[model samples]
Target: MSTAQLVSLTLAMLAGAVTLLGLVIVTGRALHRRRTRRDARLAADFRPLLLELTGGDDDIDEPLRRLAALDRRRWRAVEPSAISLLTKVSGHAHAALVSLFAQRGLARAALRDLDRFGAVRRATAAHVLGLMGHTEAAPALAGLLSDRSPEVRAVAARALGQIGAAEAADPLLASLAAGGGVPFHLVAQSLIRLGPGARPALAKALYHPEAAVRAVAAEVLGLTGAVETARVLIGVLAGDPSGEVRVRTARSLGRLGTPVCLEALIHATGPAHPHAVRVEAATALGDLGSPRAVPALCDLLGDPQYHVAHNAARSLARLGSGPAMAVLAETVAERPGTTAAGHAWEALAVLDLQAGQLRRPPTAPVS
Candidate 1:
């Protein structure tokens, strides 16, 4: 064949391929739109029945049994909206939804999907089981902590947290140690969800070799408000070699708001501590809202780190101490148009407003 003929054939083939691809794209979009409309209609149809189920209205057993009898595709269309109501309802309504989930064997289905190849599938399954609040699913969720995918691990951790199972605590801590890109904050939140039940495991984690683990543990403990953990956090602030851990500890101590924690926070603001630690300590001291921290906060107002100095000045003002107000006034006068000066002025305004509130007389009640 001639070169021109060959080129013409190739161009025609390429044009056909592109046209076919466009057709496929359009078809897929059409199917998706149809599916979305169907799901929306199903959701609307189910909304009243689900609301009645959650409302604890009479004769729900037949309606619930009818719902459970729905075909797979129809139920799939309704499931997302149904589960979404779990977060919206509470008390009898919540229990009824949980019963619905159980009766439909959703927990079992999700438990089976926990080991699915797709990360999205596994994550979705974990979420459903977690929201179901089924303790029987905890073991499966715990196993997903070691999943190869970081996203899967994170989702599983969150699921375990929502379950708030004491047994899941150790596995979650162990995952933190393994550290395959699972965020410290996510792990901390999960531990926090377990409340005091997770305290022992988190306390042990504070002694882990990795500073990240220790920091997470301290932060979670503070969030839990486990009063007994304050002493451990104070020790970390005083002696943990990692400045990051110390910073986290200082912050945790502020959340704990114990008298000893106040002492540790004051010591942390001292010049001997690292800049980051001191900055955290300054911020934490503010969180404590203690008059005792004023002198230490005043001293930190001249820190070399502008943030530390600014935070110290701001905290002092929040403390509403006479000493703090004087320090703020001095800072505003000494440095103009700087962060420290700005925080000082802001702090002064806050302090004055607080002072006004304190001095305001109680209004007489109408007879």
Candidate 2:
């Protein structure tokens, strides 16, 4: 064919493709709208019954029976709302919902969906299992932590936490290494949800090769109130090579607040440690709330590192002991031009403001 003829044919085919694409888009939107309307109708019909059952105010037996007997389409329509409430309701309402889900075989179905090829299906299943608090599905959910999809991994991590799967703690910590796309905050939250039962695992994670994992494990240990792991955290605070990890460890030790951690936290505040580590350590000393920390914290007030000295003064105030306050007062009076004095003045001013607020009379309500 001649060049002009070939070009004209190409344009004709492009026009036809564009027209076909527009038709497909219109058809897809039409179908989605229809589906949405159907879902809305179903939700309106059934969601009230669910609310009544979960509300714990009325007779739940009737609502529970109706929900349990729902046909597949109706159940599908209401499933999202039910799952959404799983995390919100508690006491009898929460228990009733779990029983309803089990009677409907949702737990088993969600377990199967965990292995589905679609990422959304896998994530949704993980979410359902987690919300249902299905302990039996914990292992399957744990497997999804390493799934190819980042979202699936995140959902799986969350589910494992909700399920209280202590076994999954190690894997959750490991996911923080190089290629694990899961957010560190999510992992930490899950570990915390796992509670003290995961402390043994979290304590074990303190020695993990990855610094990120170690840091998270240390922080979660403190948040979970794993006072038993104070020694472990103290060691981490003193010897961990990563400054970030050491900082977290010091903070955790402070939260643990065992007197055993005092030497380690004080040592961490020394100039030998990183500035960040020293700052966290100084703050942690206040959290420790030990009068013994008074001397070390007073010394920290003199450190050239502004943040370290600043935190030290605050920690001294937090100690709330006469000696600690005396140090702050003396620093303010004797070291007027110094960094220590500035921090001391701020702490004393805050104390005075708090005292004034306490002494103020309560305002009567307007009629």
Candidate with the greatest TM-score versus the true structure: 2
TM-score of each: 0.83, 0.89
Q: Ten residues in a row with the worst lDDT in model 1?
A: 357-366
- Expressed as tens digits, the lDDT of each residue in 1-367 for candidate 2 is 9999999999999999999999999999999999889998998899889889888775788999999999999888898889888889888899999999999998898888988899999999899888888999887876787899999999989888888878878788878977587889999999999877788888888888889989999999888888888887888877889999998888888898899999988888888888999999999999999999999998888889899998999999988959999999898777766778788888877777877843222233355
Question: What TM-score does candidate 1 reach?
Answer: 0.83
Give model 1's clash tally: 0
Clashing pairs in 1: none
The CA lDDT at 320 in model 2 is 93
Cand. 1 Cα-lDDT: 0.82
Residue 16 error, candidate 1, Å = 6.6
The residue pairs in collision within model 2 are: none
TM-score, structure 2 vs. true: 0.89
* Superposed Cα deviation of residue 359, candidate 1 (Å): 19
How does residue 148 of candidate 1 score in lDDT? 85
